[model samples]
Target chain A: MDIAIIFDNIGIYLEGLQTTAWLVSLSLLLGLVLAIPLAVLRTAKSYAVQAPIRAYIYFFRGTPLLVQMFIVYYGFGQFEVIKTSFVWPLFREAWFCALFTFTLNTGAYTTEILRGAIEATPHGEIEAAKAAGMSRLLMLRRIVLPSAFRRALPQYSNEIIFMLHGSSLASVITLVDITGAARIINSRFYSPYEAFLTAAVFYMTLTFMIVFLVKQLEKRWFAHLQPQKTS
Target chain B: MINLHGYGPSILEGTFLTIAVSLAALALSMLLGILGALGKLSGSLSLRLAAQTYTTIIRGIPDLVLMLLVFFGGQVFINQVAPLLGYEDYIDINPFIAGVSTIGFIFGAYMTETFRGAILAVPRGQIEAAYAYGMRRDQMFRRILMPQMIRHAIPGFGNNWLVLVKTTALVSIIGLDDMVRKASLAAGATRLPFTFYLVVAFNYLVITSISVYLLRWLETRYSAGVIRA
Candidate 1:
């Protein structure tokens, strides 16, 4: 009911918003860049090539994001070797640990999504690519990957939103994302509704924005499959 | 199994508690889902809108945020309303109850969508045929609709269950003595965070793997009479 307190802390929320935006966007971008190759290898003919990737995906998908984050953030520091390693500097920071976990988590999911799309590439399309006498790499880069990306669009959008929401967990590690910002305000004023509700509103707005953008992308990407507009 | 240093029994108890929480929440979610599905598919416009708003808000917000909101906000709201009802004793909202309700309430929105789609998937002609045979509404729903909806619902329901199992970890933040909290406590005491958390992660993996195997078997059982291209 006390809305004025939220307005007074708007600057803190904005800072939190910035942290969330960058965390989600950077991880998503890096995850996608990493996933494309892993997905290709996932659909390979050899079981040896596929088994490791499958294990990676299963581990990430099976565990909770919070547990994964903790494993990276708090768990890794338990080892003397990791503590002595050069990567210790980065591993010690909560922000790096969160981003690293989110990237791997999203990467595993995107790999699976893209693997399905790749496997589902129409029979005739591959035949046509083969007929063109293109190299295996050429056929994949030009034919399989583009269409698979299109097919993966809807699911990718959902993943993006999931990551956005998942980013809220960063608050638990002491990074002041939107949820962290709300927790701060709540402790200060003991006004849970004003604090968390404001955070919820921010999240909802961001979610709708992502949904809108994805809808536009879908429309453009699927234009060829859409019915013809006749005069 | 990593040496637990005497925390094994506590972790085992926490595992059971986690399972209990998820199952309780699952039952609550299923009830709300059926009602919300019926509400969304009902003739009343207000009912449909209410169902829509429920799903939308739940889908948008993070589960942790919602958990905090309900835990803290519910405490303040209940104490304020207690005076009017002649209950003067201070009631601290139990974290277990708060966690269960928040998770159940959130997943209910997902289940609503699943159940709604499942209901729609049941053939219209079959319903009409049941009507023609002069069956009562309740009888027709039981005999004709329920079976078909279950077949369609299994996949979505399975996905929801897997996610819900993992989501029980959030209850630990609300101070519910779940496995995650137990592991963290053991980790702190032993100063071996990796060993404990890795065990916790494997615990989750085992649960999900078993659930997947069972879900596949259920899917096959339900689709026994049907053929796919």
Candidate 2:
């Protein structure tokens, strides 16, 4: 409706978008890095190796991300010992707290997705790789990890979208992401519908882009499932 | 320092409100889910488009943003329209109603997708067979489609329920005295943030674990006829 006002505030919105992108991208990368080894430990034979990973995943997955963020940001701030610790500088900023929580939360879910994919890898494929005289590490690097990555991509894409949406919660902890920017604008202008709708559009566009990219990746990976073309 | 002095009544009161809000939201979400699913699956183009748009937009926006938007915007909208209807005094929307409706609307979008998928997974031939047997549309839906759909929908519905339950915590940001809000208050008052939040987390885990077990029981019961002995 207020086209001129929206265009006038484009710079502010773009800054918000940049922050949103940074939050999602950094969290996702860190989460994936943490998830891979955890997934391996989860499906490993030793109970001692697997137990902690299982507990970590369960605790993070079970609790709401908001509570986790608050505990990390506000709860930790309450303790005198934590304030004086070396980690105090890191925990002092809202951004670090948000990234920490997002990393843990996404790590838990990603580990589960990766574990399922790894377990779903067919036994015959692994056996065949071994028969070809490939080393255990080589087999895992080549055959197992590739297949598991492909298998996990679809669900992992959903996780990415979810994490993107969840990052908005970081706005609560004083991070000026898109949602926070929208809140600021709404409070200033008393036109919440306009501000919120604009913010929603930015989010929707990002989601649509992710969906498109995921579909392209799926088609590339599952090319064998496609009907063959007659020359 | 963490002693429960006057906090006993306040925490109890907050728990009661939390349960009340969750149940009311769940009921409203179910109603919206059914209607949205039907609309999406219907033959009419406009209805399908409308339902699709509703689910997409709601699902894209975070619940926190949506909740805030609805609370603040709804208050202003109500005030604007109230004077025209001859209501003089400013009518403030109850925080409970605002929280419930906002969460319900968001979850309803998710439930729409779940229900739609389940409905589509129902074998079409069975519905055709029922029609051939001179069964009316409603009768066919009641006898053939509904039971099978519910069986398929239970798992997804369970997931939605868990997520919806956790989302109730977001209402605390809007000043609703739900469990999380009460916990924050107690933490501030007693300077025992870790203890109070841990208690809050434990309460959630207890509620969630129990509901999950109950849901599994319902799933097994509904699916009993399908499983071969």
Candidate 3:
């Protein structure tokens, strides 16, 4: 129908795309940084070490991201202590609230994913590390974590995509991400097809890009598992 | 102890509606999944390609954009068609229906993959054996394929169900009075958004935890005779 409207509003969509890219990448980067140590703790032998980490993961994984975002965006302002705190201004901004929530949310999911990968490590590898008399920290750094990261790559790609999609919720809180841009265009022009469909195309392109990148990573990462090619 | 400020019952009602919406969407998704799976597995080229496109596009788009599209775009599309059919009044698509259909349609793609794999997992020899015994297609499917497919499908189906339940929260954006919306309403009135949203989160945790437990039991029940590594 009104396809020209989308072309005319290309600048707005570019801004929205930048916002989305920043939100997703920052949250994903921060989430991975948060997940690594927490996942290590999660696979620990002691129940005491695992309990709090379990609860954090459970809460984040169980609840919807939208609710979590709302809790941070709208919920935090309800507390006087937060209002008086040094980071109160960050909490007041919609962007920070979204980023904060996405990081914690993705962090929980990533921690679980990494924990599974770590636990699924071959038994003999750990035994070999112990036989070589390597310290726990050394063994983990040199062996367990690297393999786990590789094993976690496929699942982590899925998490990254989910985070990208989840970032669309930032639109709900008045941030002009792709969905927000589409919403603005739709409301202004009453052209939902032109607006939201364009948004969908952007999302689809990003999803395929992630999928392609992950495939390339897997081929490189899992080369050892592949059979040798005949010359 | 947390104070609800007498909005506990309202939240409970919202929880029930959330459950209702999820179940409705689940039923719709399963139906579409079965059909899509059958289409994917069908002999016709058009059917296979159609199924492939459906799942691919749905997987690529975010649920919220699709929800907004179907809710807002569906309204526009309906009125545009209605005029040609001699309808004079504007027809507003119900948010509940729009939300449910959009979610169902989206998850159907996922279910298509799950069900197709589950169906493929059913040993081909068993189906051939049934055919050799002079069993009809429907009978063979009901007696052999269904049981094994269910067993194989439980794990994936459970994961999809959990995600679907949580996705129902998006209905609030379209003005459905689900628990999230109810919590926000209560928060607005009392100016204690933290308490209300925390309660909503707790509610979701309860639902998902219970579902997880039940799904585990279902998996065990379905896997009763099967040996595992």
Candidate 4:
């Protein structure tokens, strides 16, 4: 019940909060960027074109992100080839390890989510665009990607929330995220309830905020799906 | 080539423990899921509110935070209560129990949603027919609803199961000596994190593959007559 420790060490918790925010957002942004083209390939009719991305998704989704993080962070360091390479320094930092793994993991989920959305697009819309003289790239840019993204928004928000929670795993690698701050507090004061509960409060607040923002975005972007008003 | 430097058996033992915890947690969550779903679907306002609060809070918090909080904080909470009950010694929360309960509680919230959806997916006419036959609630549930709900729930339940298996890795964080912890121990001794984690990853892949195969078969078996567009 001694809440003063949390208040006194508020700055450390804030630093952790900042790190978690950065981790989730950066990975989500990178994942979204990569998911677009990968999802396009995913919906292709050809197996050869789609197989590799499917394998990538299957591997990432099948395993735990903790193990994946270890494979990248600890696995890469075990190799002298990687250690002597240009990206060795990056592999050596916990933050980079977290970023690399989080990006790949989120990319896999987003690719799948967006692929489902893209595949659900009506065939007539594409045919209509084709008949109107829209080229493949132009039609994808104008009609397909936008609608798929909008349709994917709800699922994507869930994935985003998952990433936010997943970022807590960064603390395992000694990156000072929110969970790291809580661990620090717990060790210093032996008050797990106060330390961890404070971090939980921060997480719950963020989750609700993200949910609210996504709801607003969905209303704005999905208004076209709403019924026409009788004036 | 498997070179664990004499730690393979430990990893195997860890794998068994992983299965143990996953099964235990799965059972606990299913019970909680059914109860929570029933609560949410019931007519009582308090029941619905309680179920909703449980799902919302569990879904919002990180699983790792909850694990730490329950394992460590549960200890403190128990000690605080023990003095009033005339208990003199500190009670340690078993990591297995802690891991299972925490994962079960977290996934219960998720399973509640899936079970609720499945319950709702049961055809209305069938229920009305059962009611007209003067069947009791329990009888109607067993004879009319359970089979159909299971069929409808398989897809979502399959998904939840896969995620649940993967999430068991977190139990290692709380000192459960699960596969991940065993791999890390082996890696620490041999300084070959690559090999151990690769094995762990392969182990997980095998489990997921088997789960996928079995779930697909179950889906096909249950959906014998249902037509798909």
lDDT of 2 by residue, B57-143 (tens): 987788888898898889888999999999999988888989999999999999999999999999999889999999999999899
Could you give the TM-score of chain B for each candidate, in order? 0.98, 0.95, 0.98, 0.97
Ranking of models by lDDT: 3, 1, 4, 2
lDDT for each residue of candidate 1 in A48-123, tens digit (9 for 90 to 100)? 9999999999999999999999999999998899999999999999999999999999999999999999999999
Chain A TM-scores in order: 0.98, 0.94, 0.97, 0.97
TM-score of 3: 0.98
How much is the lDDT of residue B188 in candidate 1? 96
Encode model 3's per-residue lDDT on B1-229: one tens digit a residue. 8989999999999999999999999999999999999999999999999999999999899999999999999999999999999999989899999999999999999999999999999999999999999999999999999999999999999999999999999999999999999999999999999999999999999999899999999999999999899
In model 1 chain B, the worst 10-residue window by lDDT is: B1-10
After the best TM-score superposition of candidate 1, give how far the Cα of residue A195 lies from its true spot, in angstroms. Answer: 0.4
Off by over 4 Å in 1: none
TM-scores of the models, in the given order? 0.98, 0.95, 0.98, 0.97
Worst 10 residues of 2 chain B by lDDT: B1-10
Which structure among the candidates has the greatest lDDT?
3
Q: Write the per-residue lDDT of candidate 1 for residues B1-229, one digit (tens) a residue.
A: 5688999898888889999999999999999999999999999999999999999999999999999999999999999999989999998999999999999999999999999999999989999999999999999999999988999999999999999999999999989999999999999999988888888899999889999999999999998898899
For each candidate, the alpha-carbon lDDT, in order, equals 0.95, 0.88, 0.96, 0.94
Better of 1 and 4 by DockQ: 1
Instruction: List ranges where model 4 is wrong by over 4 Å.
Output: A227-231, B227-229
User: Any runs in candidate 2 off by more than 4 Å, and if so which?
Assistant: A1-4, A225-231, B1-9
